[model samples]
Target: MVVDDDPEIVNLVHIYLTNDGYNVIPVYNGNEALSVISHHRVDLVILDIMMPDIDGMEVCRKIRKDNVVPIIMLSAKTEDMDKIQGLMTGADDYMIKPFNPMELLARMKSLLRRFHLFTQQDGDNSSHKDDVVQINDLKINKDYHEVTYRDSLIDLTAKEFDILYLLANHPGKVYSAEDIFNLVWNEPNPSNNTVMAHISNLREKMERAAGYKMIKTVWGVGYKIDQ
Candidate 1:
């Protein structure tokens, strides 16, 4: 899916992606993109930051609340802060305006390939069980994608679950932000703030459920599921 207010850019992306054998869905606004995304299974989203009605960041946040679909942000703003803001809002990748079509295609292919690998890993490990991970009173069910604290269920988004699963699967292992980003977002590389925001969000949700913190930050590195 491609969400951009500029018809020319949208058309250009659509033509390029369709030629690359992808079924492209192009929408002119973020709201329309949201509506379409809710009803469809999109492999990835190319979202423009500035738009009428709802902006891309809000749309990205909304999508991240439940969906783990890869998002590549498009923006005219070249500032490092703007890029950081986009990634913090849940974009898997970012591209400044006037990007090469070939580069865009390359990024799309890389993201999709990683996504494929993640799904394959899930299927392969479907039956391998540590079933439950218990750190104090917090419990994470690997197979069911459920988290519980003292027997109370905790609602988590797909990204949150992925983060928890990664950490819990290897207790005491410190994962750098880049590693976490690749594992959760299925990108070859991802912005540090993207990993940080998701981890912070996950911790907040977990803390609310458990009444205490379970995930620990590893200073100068990333995070770890302290055993």
Candidate 2:
């Protein structure tokens, strides 16, 4: 799925993706994109940050609530914070405007390829069950796909869930942001902001649920779910 306010860019992207053998779905605004996504299954989303109604970040947040579908944000704003904000809001990648259509295609291919390979690796054992993982007051039930801290359920997006799962599964192991991205997002090379944003959101949720911070930031490194 592609969401952008500019028809020219949309058309160009569509043409390029079509040539790459992808079935492209294009929407002119964030609302329309959300509507389409609610009704259809999409492997990846290429979203423009600037749009009428809701904007890309909100859309990304909504999508992340239940779906782990990868998202690549396209934006005219090249500010470091803008990129960081996009990634924090659940975008899997960020691309500035005037980017090459070929690069977009390559990114899409790379993300999709990684997604497929990871799913394949998980195989039939990936089904969620009711096993509860407890670390102090933080509780995560893999079967129910639920996380709770101090007895309150934490509302986490799919991306957040995957990140937490990876960290909590290996509590003491400090995973680099790149490692988290490659393993959870299936991206060969993911943006630093993408990892940062998701980790920030995850920390927020964990803090809200546990009433204290459980994910400890390793200076100049990544994060770890403190045991």
- For model 2, the superposed segments whose C-alpha errors exceed 4 Å read 114-162, 177-193
Residue ranges of candidate 1 with Cα displaced over 4 Å: 116-126, 130-162, 178-194
lDDT of 1 by residue, 1-227 (tens): 99999999999999999998899998999889989999999989999999989999999999887777878999999987788777667776789998898899998887776555444435546464555677777777765656778899876645666788789878899999999887776656477866776687778878887667778988998899877
lDDT for model 1, please.
0.81
Clashes of 2: 3
Worst 10 residues of 2 by lDDT: 121-130
Q: What is residue 63's positional error in candidate 2, in angstroms?
A: 3.3
lDDT of residue 203 for candidate 1: 87
lDDT of 2 by residue, 1-227 (tens): 98999999999999999987889998999889888989999989999988888889899888877776878999999898999898788776789998999888887777676555434433344453324567887777765566777778776655677789789988989999899988886757566677888889889867776667888989888889878
Residue pairs in collision within model 1: none
Clashes of each: 0, 3
Give Cα distance to truth, residue 148, candidate 2, Å.
6.9
Would you list the C-alpha lDDT of every candidate in the order shown? 0.81, 0.81
